[model samples]
Target chain A: MNSQPPAASTETSYGEAIRAGFVHLLSSHREVFAIGQGLWSPWYVGNSMTDLDKLFGKARVIDTPVSELACTGAAVGAALCGYRPIVIHPRMDFMVLAADQIINQAAKWHHMLGGQAIAPVTIRAIINRGGEQGAQHSQALHAWFAHIPGLRVVMPSSVADARDLLVASVLCDDPVLYIDDRWLYERKAVLPAVSERPLAAEGPRVVRSGTDITLVGAGYSSWLCEQAAEILAAEGLDAEVIDVRVLNPFDPAVILASVSRTGRLCVVDGGWRNAGWAGEVIASVAEALDPRQLKSSPRRITLPNAPAPTSRMLEADYYIDAGHVAAAARTMLAARETAS
Target chain B: MSHRHWQSELAGLADPAQYTAPLVIEAAQGTRLMGLLRSMLVIRHTEDQIGQLVVAGLARTPCHLGIGQEAVAVGVATQLRTTDRVFGNHRSHAHFLALGGTPTSLIAEVLGKASGTSRGMGGSMHLFGREFGFHGSVPIVGATIPIATGAALAAKLDGGDSVAVAFFGDGATEEGVFHESMNLAAVHDLPVLFVCENNLFSSHLDIELRQPSDRISRYAEAHRVRSLTVDGNDLLAVEAAANALITGIRQGAGPALLEAVTYRFRGHVGPNEDIDVGVHRRMADVSAWKRRCPIKRLSEGLLAAGIVSGDELAALEREVVAKITDAVTLARRADYPDPSALHDLVYACRP
Candidate 1:
């Protein structure tokens, strides 16, 4: 497993990395354009696409009206016309209004056309939660999209990947759902120079390696796993951290391999517990490995299967944090040692 | 004008006598008129054969036939090039055939043959012929309207005179995306034409029950898109209106809507006349609408103008029938796609 240690050089925030990605795409490729609601406003999209309409022309970075369905469908249409368009939905909750276009039209176009055409459109859906946003505003529905057949679901947990994956998704000739969390935007890391690579070359990556327990997560959950690994390391309980970069087309090779050595698994998912991505990861590991190989039963930490509450106190208990993940890993280790 | 004014005009056109008269074909328009007539004939006969296939239980897919509404597609497609993007809805056989899509490929598609337009992947509702400028058609109502609008945005950005055309029905106007697409195209000044083939019924329900008014152009007007409502069964009217709107679009006049008021001879699905569905669609209404058939009207007008003799008209009919018969035979004999290749096109291979 290769670890991506931050270099001692210039640092970039996850939000700024996304901005730099847009800069690279717009400056290098003329066929690429960004369109959606509040693209020109910083308050809605944070510092990710700051003043892109000015750097590029307003025509290229279009700020459309509050018409999610039309804007998404239009981006798909432009993609069909051989342009790589990124349609941003500031809040992932309202993106459900445009699900028909994303699911039925864009995702099915390439296959429906018998591979004669492709809608190389990237849908940048931001997961906005916390601060008492209520149920309507808080959602990370990546699992629903990941279940789709044709769509490529990508969630970048690292700062470098936040930028590079956005670049790769746009350049890719398939409809990709690029999910970025606002909580990860503040993350900073010293990065290498931008190197364009195919999204197919990316999958589950091990960020931190240890043989005690296998910790798996995606998006914000992946970041929590990193923090949990640090906490576990200080207590002499070594944990291996695996960030699921690409959810769909998910390869269980890395996670399965890690579980084989550690003989223990714990997955953290930001989505709901029922039919969540955490279950999928655990299922993959359980389906492959023999029960005798596993010293303890696998475990998954996820949000409760209920709507998000508005009060901050309720939210503190509702959402799973790094502490929750660390505790879950400790419990698994303790249980396995006791069983032995 | 007031909203009532447009509704009154639509009501006037809906009168059966308004479309019974022969079209006025001039000497200079003989060739173009003949081409339009031939194309409409091809669509009608081709759909008639598809109905036969449905009756014979050969075609398993849901087929939406636009038998009487051929003038809308034939008229609009005649003025478009292979580069101009075109989109359609569930009832899109006319749109496909009018844009030079072969009867063999279309029938092969309906039959789920390897030689089909969608390579046997997409059936009747999901047809694609990008080479002929028919981008695709989906069963989802009002799905492709915004797609066509976006294609227009690309056409505008490409700095080309090419435009995009979206062919939908009056029922599609009820979809929120339809109005949203119009607004987007208008705000961006996109080069797109919204062609609404208003047969006045969404499935078994009449438009009067669905909306405050049966006229769909009012929605276009609400979006400030310049629109024209014409007798869709009249070939000359549809052609002229489509030509004018397309010309304006090419000249950077934003988007335009052409609402062609026409009817379907067959049911919403399959081969029956649907007169006995026990809905508002009575046999009397169907019989009257058939009398105002677009193909019959155009053929009579051409004959009256001395563009073609009686024998020539008969020969054209025979020729179209024989051609479609041969195409259907070939399509029926073609092989179905191998089951192993089903997953090949789910994702595009990286270049």
Candidate 2:
């Protein structure tokens, strides 16, 4: 069991890494660019997208006119015309405004055209930060995108992984959903190297390893699980924490491999609990592995079905903190120990 | 004299006794116009065949056939090119055919065969032809209009002379996005053309019953877009409107509107003109529309001009029927999409 994470994978916060990576890609490729409402503005909202406009030029580092729907449609149009636009929706909450462009157009165009047209557009959506932004802003809607068939949904938790995943997403020949939360961007880590041959790269790259228990996490929650693993490791628990960077085309091979050995799994997604991405992962794991392989039942930690709370106090009270994640992992391990 | 050969209801629209002006067949327009006429005829015939197929339980798709609305597509597409982007609504057979998509693929898609435009997945509603600049024709009423506007903005940004066209029905105007799109296109001066087929019935309710005024061009005027109103069944009128608007767009003029005042012989939903009609548009109105057949009018004018003899016109009709028959047969025999194709097309198959 390769319990120890490689030093190469360790880096700065997921946010900084993603921004640095985007700046690098935008600088290297002219056709590639970043566009959003606060992307290249004087007041940069998505932390990773700061200073991108100055480095990449105004044409590439575009600032939209507070129109999510228009910009997304423009991005799709630009992509169809051969320009790879890395459109930033900034907040997952605003994606509802762009639903027509996302669902009816972007996701269905290639198939509608009988695969003659492939929109190589990448949208970076900030999601599930568990902030005081309330129902309007704080949302983990990765599952919404994951449910869509044509889009490649990505959720990067760590800085280095954020850069790697986003760079990889841009190279994809189809539309990709590169989502990282507002809170996750400021969280720094080491930078990871990029895959040069992205065309051959299919989906979800596993960034962490474990044997005793699988801690499946993505976006900010992945980091939460990693922090939780440290607290559990001190108590002599060998928990395998897997950062589910790519959410939509979830890598079953890596996930199943980790779960097969561990025999215990816990999916921690910041999305709403009832039918969040955690449910999808849990369901998929159960379907893929035989019942006998399980030493303990898989579990999940997610947001309650209610709308995100409004006040900062309520937000802090409701956040799925590292302590909550550790306790969940501890409970899983205890359950397995009891079963055995 | 315009030979009034319309169905019983449409006979009064024009006087058969008086001479109706020739639709004309100039030296340059003969070959291309003939091709356009044949394309519209193919669409009309395919829908008729699909109507039968639906009854025979061969096809399960709910096809919105624009049989009487052929002139709109043929007329507008005559001015379009491989570079211009086009978006269509649920009834987009002529839209696809006008942009040069194969009749076989159209029939194959409607038949839910793998040889379909959408590989049998999207059926009748969703069709696309990007290589030929037919972006997509979706079922969502006014969804693609804004997309076309965005595409027009992109063309302008890229410094391309290409224009984007949105082919939607009068019902689609009710969508908020349609107004927003027109406003954006006009203010941005994007090279986009809005072609509204005001067939007067959105699903069942008449345009008059819905809007305060019967003229949808009023909305275009509200957006400050240069507008044109024409008889949709007149192929020459459609062509003239399309040519003028397309030319204006390519010349860097902002978005323009061309509203073709026409009527569909069929019902709102399918090949049958009988179902889904409101209490207002009577059988008499549909029968009256028969006198305004764009194909018949053009053929009569051509026959009178000696540009085409009666035998030549007959030969053309026979050729169209034979071609459509062949396309249908080929489409029917074509393969269905493999299951593996289902997963691959959704995401970017980078390899």
DockQ winner: 1
Task: Return the lDDT, model 1, position A116.
Answer: 76
lDDT of 1 by residue, A1-340 (tens): 0125345786879998888899899999999999999988877899998889878989999999899999999999999999999999999998999999999998898787677789999999999889899999989999999999889999999999999999999998889999999999999998778879998788999999999999999999999999999999999999999999999878889999999999999999999999989999999988899988898889999999989999999999999889999999999898866877
Report the C-alpha lDDT of model 1 over B126-225, residue by residue, as the tens digit. 8888888999999899999999999999999999799999999988998999989999999999999999999988888766667778778888879999
Q: Name the lDDT value of residue A15 in candidate 2.
A: 60
lDDT of 2 by residue, A154-248 (tens): 87776666777777778777888888777765676556565544633545445556677888888788888888888888898887888777676
Model 2 off-target regions past 4 Å?
Answer: A1-13, A51-59, A128-131, A192-211, A290-292, A335-340, B1-36, B277-281, B304-306
- The alpha-carbon RMSD over the true interface for every model, in angstroms, is 1.5, 2.4
Model 2 gets an lDDT of: 0.77
* Interface C-alpha RMSD, model 2: 2.4
Candidate 2's residue-wise lDDT over B1-351, tens digit each?
A: 122331222232222322234576776677766677677777777777777777777778888888778889988987999988888889998899888888888889988888888778788898877778888788887877877876786687678699999999989988877887787678678899999998877998866556665677889879899989887877888889889988988998889999887778888876666666443447676776766777677776666666667887788778877888888789889888888777666665744
Candidate 1 chain B least-lDDT 10 residues: B1-10
